[model samples]
Target: MPAALHPDFLRLPVAHRAWHDRAAGRPENSRAAIRAAVAAGYAIEIDLQPSAENRPMVFHDYDLKRLTGRPGKINAFTADELAATRLIDAEDGIPSFAEVLEIVAGRVPLLVEIKDQDGAMGPDTRGFEAEVAAALGTYAGPLAVMSFNPHAVAAFHAARPDIAVGLTTSSYRPTDWVFLPAAACDALREIADYDRVGASFISHEHDDLARPRVAELKAAGAGILCWTIRSTEAEAAARMVAHNVTFEGYRALIPG
Candidate 1:
């Protein structure tokens, strides 16, 4: 049997992007948002991607237009340049992964999502995973890493076997990845390579939890988690199947 996942990770309500509320000046992955989650005693989830300087920055989009209102890719700017570009509707700018970790400071557990760089996913591809590992080298707290790409999970697991890792799954549609061939999209959607990736947990799409594979994984004791829960009904339904949730949009109705 695989190793049992830490119970603390399965019990806490994970704040997706740190309780971000743009109107409140707390943007997703911003310092203020992370602090809010910490105060609420909820675990925090953040996204990591490298800037031009190879420093891991805490952000979500590949392009800067959506959040930063800048006309360029996130990697086009150095860490300092990214930090100086203000996030819309908030005073905070893009934060370095190290800075976000410091702000959390073990106040709550963390779930780090490694964003995919275009279509690159293999271990021999970009070194974003290594950069993330290095940034997190000294973080002495409850934390786990996850990604939509199985290769990303595998790369991290190979480097830091001690740190728990997970795979994010969704029922893929052709529109989801127009560049990929149908077979490739099918493989990703089915999570067919999960066993080979050595992931300790599964952060699946809430709607996709009814799949037989998800139930089997849960019964076999792989930690069952789900993401992007935004409403009370969705949270309630997801909790019925998944052990814990990654939530955002309105306050989460935590499972009893």
Candidate 2:
């Protein structure tokens, strides 16, 4: 049998990259945004990027140019060095996964996505799974880990069997992902890796929730989670198929 997502995770809206509001000075994945998500009583979603030391950092991009305005790969820096670097708008530093756990302190459920280190989403996982398992050893929280790469998810599940694992699915629209070759997208579109990776859930692209494969997964008892919802209409649409939503940009409604 596949692992399962805990019930609490489906009860509330998950803040995508935390409750980020750059105009309000809480940039995505910043400590301030995560804190705000906790205070607002929403589940928090974050991404993990490996650092120079192979430690997991709470970051979205492999490169620092966009978020930090610095011109190097995030992995080029050690944990301390990355933490010292500030996000452009908020002046908050890039925090490690360990630091994020401290900030969240298990206040709400966490949804963590492990960024693919190798561009191919291939089998070379860089031991990030084991590294994250080590970091999460002491965190007694309601959380789950997922990745776009099946290999990474499988690796993580092996190392941390107690934690739930899932796949971050996509519609595999070619224009949307220029870097991913069309063949790769086509292969991933079918979600053939779902069972192989022991994934019990999938966080799929919001616009593609109506995909037949998504419904099939749900019927097979897989949890259905949706991503990057930014409007109430979209939220309602996603809720039609999703157990819950990972949202950003606007406040999401919690069910009564």
Candidate 3:
């Protein structure tokens, strides 16, 4: 793996969300947030979703009520509609994935979580993944693609093996959240299966890092990345325990 995509994420602590300080101009998934992360010397990880017209945009939620105060589904709005919507974090404009890429350039590696809910891909998504790949073609920095939907990750990896792919899970979802289901195995078998799927890393909620399955992942040549860590001290503690990298709400951890 390239230094940028190294299995060991310990080199730079990742911020889960972009440095979106509502008071400062940093809005999650906005170009401003990406710029802030670059200025702070921290790598960035962001979420991608297709707008109504199938254009790729930087956003994390399926609904727009929280960020935009506009009650509607993200996929229900066209790019122009989304563009017209302002981030509730002080009138910051929502940014396109391309715009964010331009701002960050190669300043820091990026981990993109592609939205593949319900198997929506290709033309159904206006070829969002292909567009993302095209945008990334202009970037020289390290890049990794991830998804909670295995099919999405598989599709991206099959198309572009050059970029590493990670599989993410959360404790809340009983079905897909757990990599290995009881039918597969009651124990650590799920982690092993995910590794078999060519996943370079396992990104899970911070709490999941404590499950006994983590050791199984380590043994399978996979790395551990915990998500949404908000505090520096919590990050330190997680690193000491099981996580090799952390996404703490968009702030990259700069080593002292």
Error of 3 at 225 (Å): 1.1
lDDT of 1 by residue, 202-229 (tens): 9998887888888888887779899889
- Model 2 agreement with the true structure over 3-66: per-residue lDDT tens digits: 6788878998999999999998999999999999999999999999999999999999989999
Residue 60 displacement (Å), model 3: 0.6
Q: Which residue pairs of candidate 2 clash?
A: none
Give the root-mean-square deviation of each candidate in angstroms: 1.8, 1.0, 4.1
- lDDT by residue (tens digit), candidate 3, 154-249: 666766778788877555443643534554333222554464446878777776677767667667566677777877676777776554555544
- Give the candidate order by descending TM-score: 2, 1, 3
Off by over 4 Å in 1: 1-4, 118-124, 253-256
What TM-score goes with each of the models? 0.94, 0.97, 0.82
Deviation in Å, model 1, residue 219 alpha carbon? 1.5
Better of 1 and 3 by TM-score: 1
**Overall lDDT per candidate, in order of appearance:** 0.83, 0.92, 0.68
Model 3 error, position 68 (Å): 0.5
